[model samples]
Target: MNTLQRRNAIKDELQNQKLISAKKLALKYGVSRQTIVGDIALLRAQGQPIISTVSGYKYQEAGTAYHGVVVCQHTIEQTREELEAIISLGGEVVDVLIDHSVYGQIVGTLGLANQADINDFMSRVKNVNHNLLASLTNGIHLHNISCSDEKVFNSIQQRLDDLHFLYHD
Candidate 1:
C-alpha cells in the first residue's frame, strides 16, 4: 500500500481498538520503523489527537466521554490542599493544566486515587522540588478531574468552591 493508505489504515485501526504500537504498524504495513514513525507524524500533523502513553498510542476523538477541565487559582499550599480534597471526594485528579506564555497549554497527568497515592505523589513532587509542569505556574493551574457521575462532579466542585479554590470568571 501507499504511504497515505498505510497511514489511514493505521489510524482506522487505532480508532477501532483505542491503542496501536509502532512495531505492529510496521509489520502490518511492511514498512520500516522510520516509515511508521513518519506516518504517525503525518497523522498527528493532520490534527489527530493521538497521545503516546507507555502502553501505546491512543486517539482522543472530539466529544469523547471524559471529564472536563476546571480552572482554579490558589497558593501553592492551597493547591496541595485542593488536590487532596478532590481525591478524598473519590474523584481522580487526571492532570494539572497550565498555560505558558511561550509553550501554550501544558498538562501533566497525576493519577492519584487516594491518600496513600496522594502522599506518594506529593513526595515525588517535593523530591523534584515541585518543579513539575504546572508547578512553574505558582499554583494557578487547571485540573482535569474525573468522577463516576455528575453528582460526584457537583460534590467535588462544591468542595472546591467551599475551599475558595474554584476560579470564577
Candidate 2:
C-alpha cells in the first residue's frame, strides 16, 4: 500500500480503537517512524481531529462524546484559584494544553483534583525548572476538564465565568 493508503488505514484504526502508537502503525504499514509522523501531520492537515497524548494518538469523530476543553486566561498567580474552582465543582483537571509555535500543542497532564494535588504539582514544576503550561503562553491555556454530571460542569463554568477567567475566543 502507498503512504496515503497507509495513513487512511491508520486513521480508521484510531477511530475504531481508543489509542494507537506510532511504532504499531509503522510496523503495520511497513514504514519508518518518520514516515508515520509525516502521515500523522498529513492527516491533521486534512482536518482530522487527532490528539497525541502520552499514551498514543486519539481520533475525535463527530457524534463521539468527549468531556470538553475549556480555554481560560489568567495571571500565573490565579492558577491555584482556577484549579480550586474546578475541584470545588467536582471536576477533574485532566491536563493543561498550550500552543507552541514550534511543537504545536504542548500538553502536560496535571491529574490534579484538589488543592493539595495542585500544591504538589506546582512544587514539581518549580523544582524541575519547568513552567506551567499557561505560563508558556503568558497565562493562556486550555484545560481538559471532566466531571460526573452536567450540574458539576455547569457549576465549574459558572465559577469560572464569575471569576472572569473563562476565555471563549
The TM-score leader among the candidates is 1
**What is the per-residue lDDT of model 1 for residues 91-111, given as tens digits with 9 covering 90 to 100?**
877667899988998877565
List CA RMSD, all candidates: 5.8, 6.7
Estimate, for each residue in 23-97, the C-alpha lDDT of model 2 and write its tens digit: 888888888988988888889999998866534577753442336678899998788789889988788787889
True-vs-predicted CA distance for residue 41, candidate 1, Å: 13
> Which pairs clash (backbone N, Cα, C closer than 3 Å) in model 2?
none
Off by more than 4 A, model 2: 1-66, 127-129
> TM-score for every candidate vs. truth?
0.59, 0.58
Q: Write down the TM-score for model 1.
A: 0.59
